[model samples]
Target: MKIAVFTWNLQVYNHKKAVLSKHVVEHIMRALFGHAATGMPFIGTLLEIKAPRRKDTRPYSEESIEKIVKALQDEFQSHEFKIIPRIKAIDCGGLPNTREWILVIYSGFSDVSIESLGFRKKIAHLIKAENLKAILKAGQRTYRPRQTYHTHGLADIMPNKNHFEKMDTFRIDLKKDPMKTAKEASRQSKLLHQGDAFDEDGDLPLLKQFRGETTGIYTSDGSDYSLNIEAIKKRGTKIANQDENWYRDGCLIKAKAVDSKGEYRISVVSIHLPGPNHTARDGNILNTFKVVGFRSNPDILIGDLNTHTEVIRELYRDLSTELSTGTTLKFNSAIDFGKTKYDRAILRTTSIWKHHSIAITAAEEISSRPGKIQPIRYERVSDHGMLTVVLHDGGS
Candidate 1:
């Protein structure tokens, strides 16, 4: 038995503003799964799909889900598959109208069960735990006024004094000046407590806040001096927020397939990690593994990790087999930035399937010239190249 799995990141927000036409949808489906003539059973993990809604700025409605399902069904008229769509909304401050979602479509399976790990809730918990540590560290510090620089004009210069008067203007060295550092830390603690560091819902703020203060000193000879203090304040280290970045909550799907010989269980996790913050992305991936439990790793882990770094590779090296689908992202895309290999799939080494091969499909030629290839639909449909994996059961 062989099953083909496909993973793609549909750039819904940037591609057609989340409004996909039926033709475009059909084009994408055909490119990934091939025509019904092939008669291949497969599973697809689609990320960043914008659900249809009445308004552009409204959260996806139930009507939208129905419409998406209808679109899938219309495309795969001959295939019998289950469409599992999960809404991954942005709710950091308040619910925004972001309609990004993850859809897992699978067929040729006897039974399938999907589970929502509450990925966002896990992200919140991780952030809050780090914030508490930051607060504790801030509590031990004191607040000190920043250094001031004073300059006097000719009128203020005494007759006996030199024509020029200079005061120490160098920036305060927080490392050398423990007092000042402690003071700054105390101020940070206060700001964090005042809800300035975190959002209304207690989640870490996505944007940094600016704070400035000025203190004036009176000098004899009718002269005055002032110190202008400024600081870029944030409660703790910045983490990834689904609302602010091109991120959507991921889910785990499990299925049972029956063959002539017997039945086998298949587990797959579809995910899209935050791209801006590397530290946050790494932490989230590790946290996801924890949530999924290392004791029972999924058979297939597929999605856009937003990066292809050594750290990420090392994390999965021992647990799974990786497919090197070169440059799974489209060229000249906004997020491309010279970095490729964003989308990927990994199969557990202990899975029942023994062999696999990969194919890159949906290459849309932006230019009539040769070698000017882009992902099918590119900006119009998606910015990611479609990747398909065929898993073999190693039996006749």
Candidate 2:
């Protein structure tokens, strides 16, 4: 079987693209899931969701910008937009209210039931659940002109005949693995196909949400097997245990999956180790994750580890022994990583599959696409380019 391991850090586009948090999504979905003429094989995407900013600084003065940047950096925190009675544009006066700020969400998709024609859905129900009324009810009418929230009915996510609720999605959160206690996890693979019986509000809200760094695992819509984040652990104590209610990051998502071939293992980790102590913590996280994958006898390990200079060099050296160090193409970030450096991903070797024909999409290619341009933000959809690894699970 051919599978694509794709990892991208969508710095959480902060502009009109993130307004409805809709159109920007469609563009990305279309890229990987759009080709109907040719069916896409299994793909695992480690999407590091972009984050929401407290406010866009484009319209502010140099003095104010310096102060805000200093305050966030000094305190070691990223600000999220607060609930405003009426969210207004940051268009300082004569500035035509064009720019918008948004957040980076960590979400993934695979094994979608109704993705054959494409992954299109009306998401009005979703909007209400997330309580994004500020974005939907901004000013004269709706902040997002294209939002499919029917003018007459509930938001379209589960709108009518084509509703996600009816599709029987097999979702299981690793934090509460329903099958781990079983004698053998693989034996309980059938559980993934069961209907949506759990209370969405209670059981799986955090797992199945469009929030920050929430790793997702969607099994192939046609496959008989299913995958779940069977376990989760924090690598960096500080990064994982931050006090902020809105911020969530630094996690190792160890998954147990059963396919037609049988039970196997893999991992999706997002390590956000920042500040002066980043390099050491980053190493700790990577080393720990690799050891686990090896013990589990896995397929692949996909996700981000916010690595910088020394950490990047060390990661490649450490994984060289077991994992295939495929081609790594790093892209530049607007937030200067000491000038030229950018975010990158590197996949190590495992037992279940062989890596081949690996490639990274050109930054220019994705960056070139035209959209509602924001002077300082929109040019870069994501600071990091996507890394794709082709894996052959059969006779290599």
Candidate 3:
């Protein structure tokens, strides 16, 4: 059996007026699965999909997972498809908008089960736990008390009442008081553990809670656990100043497929990592593997990694999976930036699949004028090209 898995950053969030038109949705559906003339089953890992809100009306209404699925169903005319929409509410630098999502759309598979492992959330929890532990440890440290004048005799010895006022103005340092500091740290850690540290109104909202449309084991609760003060400041600074969100996450899909020889189980992961910060991206990749567990590797891992550094490359290499080559990004005339590949798919050599081939779409152009080829105006679809990895079962 040969399965086609594709990863694309749909860029719906970047759309003009942040609206994805019906025609654009249909174009995406056709461009991705329509070209599979070989009748091979397809699994599409689409990223940066903007979820529709009730406040959005008219032209903005069609930009949703439901609309995308409807377009796919209309294009394929088959009822054998399943969609796993992992809606993640992003914190856009304390901004009101939190609408981006990731989607895993599959077709022509009967025994397929997709799930959100919550590995990323678990990683956040672990990091928070460690941070709180450190704070608690710091709070337990003994500190020498600063010398202070006895207030009873200080006023009599003072040159004027102004000196007394100045002495009274000195604030008591929390570090000098271990008991108070410990109690405060304990209270904050408890609030964090109980998910009460965050302001109720400021919490990121999850779409699954209201829509009830997601079909997976895990629907994100939109709880952020990266509570380290410095980490929060770094992320906040980048989000506010650089206009980029550093929150990253992914999901797992398990399916059983049959070939000429026998049936085999396949594991696929759809991932999206932080884009602007390389350090965060690297840590995210490392924690992603930890979330996935180091014991077993997924058969296929696909998504936008924003891979521009060798650290990311080496991390994937250490995982025994090689990222598919070729430029996956399209030229941006708005930014005057040339093409570069950041989106990719990894097919594990240790997996059941024996052979593989990759194809990149939505990044090239055909000439309307005779013999006058031109670059694709990819802004119609996305900033990143669609990457499809075809894995063979090595059976005749």
Clashes of 3: 1
Better of 1 and 3 by TM-score: 1
Tell me the tens digit of each residue's lDDT in model 1 across 1-396.
777777777665332333343444455456645554343456777676654433333334544645665655554563332222222232212222344666677666756777664565545544433332332333222122212111122222322122112111111233366445444433332221112323344333322222434222212122222222221133333322322222245677778777777877778776766553553445665555446433347777777766555323323432212434443544555223233566667666667765467755544433222223643342434566666777877673
RMSD of each: 12.9, 21.0, 13.8
Best by lDDT: 1
| TM-score of decoy 1 | 0.59
Which digits, one per residue and each the tens of the lDDT, describe model 2 over residues 369-391?
A: 44446443344455544555555
The alpha-carbon root-mean-square deviation between model 2 and the true structure, to one decimal in Å, is 21.0
Candidate 2, 51: how far from true, in Å? 4.9
Instruction: After superposing candidate 1 on the true structure, give the runs of residues whose Cα lies further than 4 Å from its correct spot.
Output: 13-36, 51-60, 78-99, 132-229, 233-248, 276-295, 310-325, 333-339, 363-380
Report the lDDT tens digits of candidate 3 across residue range 296-354: 47776777656554323222322213434433443443212234456656656667765
Off by over 4 Å in 3: 13-36, 52-64, 78-99, 126-188, 191-248, 278-285, 293-296, 310-340, 363-378
Clashes of each: 4, 24, 1
Ordered from best to worst lDDT, the candidate numbers read 1, 3, 2
